[model samples]
Target: SVEELRKLLSDKDAYENYLHSIEEVKQLDTLRNDLRKRNVTLARHNLGKESEMAELRNQCMIIRTTELATAQEKFLDAQRREKEILARSSPASILNKLQEAANAADDESESLHRKLLSGELKVPEFLQKYRQQRVLYHRRTLLRLAA
Candidate 1:
């Protein structure tokens, strides 16, 4: 009778161990499902970040292109203005015209002086003409200084 009781106790212990193993398996399956859900959420978040980055990059490229085009247009406008200025008044032609003006002023002063010396112009007339000539000369000098 004691041997029979030992056999029954041993069988009961084996059954309990099998039931514990099954519970452990169920816990492992639950943990696996939770991990799978977290992985899907992370994947979606990564995709959203990547899309935002792409849009930002496109906007940056568009801004850069517009700025470059504006700069190019401004550069072309400046070049056109420079050409117009050069065509209207080249340095050589401006210098030649200035030289001719100086020579004319000198000749006029010498002629006035000769006329006064020869009594061709009265003292009063000569003084007035001389003052006018001096004013003209001074104006020219001021213009040259300003330039």
Candidate 2:
């Protein structure tokens, strides 16, 4: 009988301490569940963002391979064309062309005179065309000399 009575009187604050502990444990469990839900939501959002980033990276690679490569090739072709044009536009080449043009103009005037004498060309037409060809020859000669 005395053992039972001593157990009943063992610590007057035990009941109050147990109740407080239970409340604290309930609050902690609720907080843990809320944190778990938040973590799941954040993980899903992170996964979505990572997938979007990967897709964007893939598109960039496609553009780099196709569009950028095409543009680079076009640029190279343009550079080659420019080099060819520059080569053909050298001073010596320009001077030679002017001399050839003068010769051609002189030959054309001679042909017109021959045609006039042969009666293949009318007098007024022959005069006009011959004068134009002679003027062109003189102009080409002047240009060739200047060059």
Candidate 3:
């Protein structure tokens, strides 16, 4: 009877772990969807602002402000992903690795932005207004380099 009880408890633990993994995947999916929606909204806003540039002499300044806001939003999205990965990580050490990866991505994106702003790199008009795209590009480049 004791052996049977131990087996039952082990099975329960395994079942619970499986459920947790499923939940984590769902959470990650939700975060991805939300991030995509935010990106689309940012693009639409920037396009609309650019379309009115002839009438609004302040379009360039507005684009810069919007670009900053979009970058901040992308940063927040990465933060959320970092948190989710941390939560999903097992043995706990994986959380640190995931967080480090996210932070490194953020750092690379910031460096690119600084270079663009300092005129070290020439950024086209569309890129100047779309900071999230720049962040994504930088983040992917960093990840690839790390890999």
Candidate 4:
């Protein structure tokens, strides 16, 4: 009877251990499932970020291309205007024209001064003509300086 009782106790202990192992296995399976869900969420988040970054890069490239085209068009327009100006008047010819106008103004001023001194022109008329000649001469001089 003692041997039989010992054997019965041993069977009870083995059954308890088997139940504990089953519980541990269930806990491990729950943890594995949680880790799998987290991995899926992280993968989705990474994909969204990658797509957003790609769209932003494309937008930046488009903006840069538009700006480059506008700048190139402006450069070409400036070049065309420069060519037209050069064709119409060379710098040397422009300077010569200004010089001739200045000389003519000086000659007219001298004639007006002579007429005033000789009493051939009235004082008011001489003053008016002298003022006009002086203004013309000054304008031509300023133009030459700017050129």
Q: Is candidate 1 or candidate 4 better by lDDT?
A: 4
lDDT score for residue 94 of model 4: 84
Ranking of all predicted structures according to TM-score, beginning with the best and ending with the worst? 2, 4, 1, 3
Estimate every model's Cα lDDT from 0 to 1: 0.80, 0.89, 0.72, 0.90
Task: Supply the TM-score for candidate 3.
Answer: 0.26
Give the residue spans of candidate 2 off by over 4 A: 1-29, 44-56, 63-97, 116-128
Model 4 residue runs over 4 Å out of place are 1-88
lDDT of 3 at 19: 58
- TM-score of each model, in listed order: 0.36, 0.50, 0.26, 0.40
Each prediction's total of clashing residue pairs, residues at least 3 apart in sequence or on different chains, is 0, 0, 0, 0
Model 1: which ten-residue window has the lowest total lDDT?
138-147
lDDT value for model 4: 0.90
Give the alpha carbon lDDT tens digit for every residue of 23-131 in model 4: 7777987899999999999999999899899999999999999999999999999999998889659988789889899989989999999999999999999999999
- Tens-place lDDT per residue, model 1, 20-90, is 56977768878998999999999999997998999999999999999999999999999999998886598
Q: How does model 1 fare in lDDT?
A: 0.80
- Higher-lDDT candidate among 3 and 4? 4
The predictions' CA RMSDs to the true structure, in order, are 10.1, 7.6, 39.1, 10.3
**Where is model 3 poorest over a 10-residue stretch in terms of lDDT?**
90-99
**What's the TM for model 4?**
0.40
Scored by lDDT, model 3 comes in at 0.72
